[model samples]
Target: MSPLVKKSTGEFEEFDEQKLRRSLKHAGAIPSEIAKIIQQIRPLIHEGISTKRIFNHSFRLLRRYSQECARNYSLKKAIFELGPSGFLFEKYVAEVFKAKGFKVKVGVVKKGCCVKHEVDIIASRPDKTIYVECKFHNHPNRKNDVKTALYINSRFLDLKNNKANEFDEFYLVSNTLFSKDAVKYADCVGVKLLGINSSYGDDIQAIVNKYHLHPITSLQSLKKKHIHALMSREIVLAKSLLKQKKTLFELGLDEMEIKQVFSEIKNVRRSYE
Candidate 1:
């Protein structure tokens, strides 16, 4: 057999269950559970089977052993699933801010010196106001580079006069990691960051866990088509999807899957809560 290719990017590489093993371990699976998952999925590893399939299979099996590990698995794609653009992430961030007691508005356009700029999020409280930029990425490996940091900082600076008035601080939030230079600039220039590799060091999962803002696209009981079907309707959060269980009907999932996924969603919500 030739080398294996990843489903996400079509890059071919050799299979190593050790990587899966390590990921499960890092996600808090014990050694015995880790070995069991690798042993089960190892045979499915061969030429042409996408690593994404392998990963989904591994996560499915891993869930039976450790739900925590399964849920903590890279949540980057869930936010990625939210888009044609970063709209869903922006909405989700707004939801997070709402949960944190900020009055939130998305796609805020304001006059800078020369032109108008749209802020991804504007959240105000009785005490302070903040503006936010959400940097969404599909891949966990894709980091918010320094260029992004500089551009966002400049955008904040241009809006610093705040013609609308408020916003004591500006924050950049991302579903993926951040570059070293991005973090450095943020620290030096005082642009607050809430990214995976942020200087402030907040885990997106931890926020999701705290606020129960689980992404519907991460449901393993639902296949890619099922997730996509929901995403198409702007149903990105698990909390929202499970509320309208009937929406799952049009996604072409059978009754069994519907029931199964509702159960998974309940468990996922419980995990986050």
Candidate 2:
């Protein structure tokens, strides 16, 4: 019988190796590396093992096998590092939209029919404009619930009514998943949602991977202070680091540290190629 593994949400279920295998494959691990990782991980599995422990163990092994794969596997956890505040995640989301060819404005205050509201993001293309509300949580199991969707939709309606022609769509995006009630509410109201496992086919993870917009926090080489410093300079994406050699120097990264940062960046870039 499979040992029961505890999830981050405090739920328990029978361990499924196939689920672990799929995640490894998604992280760009080759078949041989995946098998090796599983071989090592299976012995560590025991009753009531936390998913976090399993992840850490797998990540360590994957890092040994390939830096790029480890980085890719760590993407979700890295996003959490974007905050003790949601502001950085908001900026990251803006970058994602910018990569998708939308001209984005973050932290915009627009007057609504009822009152003024500060929007997290306003993404516009030539033909349409989208108002985005970003809900970022540090915990993976934290979900955007029905109340969140209801509030966001109400705000959208106020803005849309006030400037109906200006905004064509509203999107509620998050780094975490949404509850079923949230999804249902959003669907009923015509508000779009983009989060993990989104039915719309454009979840945050998918978009990030699709455009190679991995956040700088995703780099194992960078410390928290280093990440905050880069973000303060508006350098959010890992790809952007390639052109910011001067900024890196200003951040006080010594020769060895800079070399490590650049090396990890190269490996991350190569993962897609």
Candidate 3:
């Protein structure tokens, strides 16, 4: 194995298997499977090999043995592929809320004190209305920071100031982590923040598993661009992928690719069910 490794950013850094092992474990791979993954990919590590290559190799192997772990590890990338439109993320979040028994509305527009605010996602219950601002990041290096918390909190305040009879709490939900300052400000101001890996809870992984809300990008057969194209049409879930079968061809996936994609979808559907 080479000491130096190429990062996704094109930066070279020392290889640390501990970080790799930690990531595999975090994705819910069992100890034995994690060890097997390292053993399988360990030999191919070279000084100049892109980490992407290493990851793809390991993911292929992991997907064979543990679809659950592979999909969990791919969660962020799956969400990233939903980009060019954050609305898909909002819809995904809404699905999670629906799974939890909330009546969710996406892109809800309501009047604010200073301006008209189109809230990203909203959930209503018998006793409360949950106003949500969905912040989505495409890369792991980025996080929901203090400025976002501040801006969202201000928006919450404006919404509250309005006479609109809504919302017991204002929440900012992201498929990423929050900065320390973001957490601090939210806590101080009583604004709830829900991030994928947030310490404050609303664990995205737990919610996904609970709701079986794995995104379409979890399919190993779909490439990044294919995912973005599907997402542009607001297709995010595995179920949606099956329903909008024509969208696959519209995205330019040929016959072979489409067949493979459907095959992957079948496996994914089985795992979740």
Candidate 4:
């Protein structure tokens, strides 16, 4: 289809499986990572699913994956399933801070006043620690807004010890284009609001530009590439096995029995790959 005609359809032109896959690939995602993400959203696949819808669906699945697995799994793995964008941004944000010679840890579990919350990215120096919360949502809610404020305010004192520390600062990061009200609320609650492609405090663009971040595309690609590679390698290995000599005696089988082993291996590989 012509580019103009595709645009006229009111659907995003680059929102399908192939496009998403390419985006992910371009963003430097591995195949296995992409495949795991694909598995998470496979049940939702349908004939008419658009690329944009697919991307969004994959993102939601990633969030679900992170939230569910964070408690039990390693922080990096949970974040890996979250998709490239979140993973990458979280990574480089920490990287940028660390690049400046700071101590940084991604996905730190901290005790909040009412709950144990996983802060997206944490940076610490000799004097203080900074808590950063990252968000990429279509909309914001009042309840969530209030809770964020409480999170930051509550950060001043350790929930466990009720002691104040100088190393505390709250940074609320978002990919959604922030609204004036959202900025106001963030200010009212004493949290700094940051938006992708927009200035937050100072040199915000410098950091974004430095990383050249594309979270969704990079993540989807990594997942697909890793899984696809694994599938491909397994296929090659299975094929090689078929060409090799067969051992019938292992199963105490006759001549006909050895062929069954060959067939079974091929079938198993086919099913998995």
Q: What RMSD, rounded to one decimal, does every model reach? A: 4.9, 4.1, 4.1, 16.0
- TM-score (C-alpha, index-matched) for candidate 1: 0.72
State which candidate has the highest TM-score.
2
With candidate 4 superimposed using the best TM-score fit, by how many Å does residue 95's alpha carbon deviate from the native?
A: 2.2
TM-score of every candidate: 0.72, 0.78, 0.75, 0.41
Report lDDT per candidate. Answer: 0.77, 0.84, 0.80, 0.48
Whichever of 2 and 4 has more lDDT, that candidate is 2
Comparing 1 with 2 on TM-score, the higher-scoring candidate is 2
**Tens digits of per-residue lDDT for model 1, 95-124:** 888878999988978887656789889999
| Per-residue alpha-carbon lDDT of candidate 4 for residues 195-258, written as tens digits (9 for 90 to 100) | 4334356333344233322112222212344333423332212233344343224324455644
Better of 2 and 3 by lDDT: 2
Candidate 4: residue 191 lDDT (0-100): 72
lDDT, candidate 2, 1-273, per-residue tens: 899999988999999999888877756789999999999999999999998899778878988998656554577777888887898889889998898899999999999998999999999999888989999998776999999999998998889788543888899988888888999899999989987545564677667777888889878898888888887876778888888888889889888998898899888667667
The residue-level lDDT of candidate 1 at 239 comes to 75
Best-first order by lDDT: 2, 3, 1, 4
lDDT of 1: 0.77
Query: Which runs in model 4 stand beyond 4 Å of their true positions?
Result: 1-88, 112-115, 138-161, 164-166, 210-273
* CA shift of 213, model 1, Å: 1.0
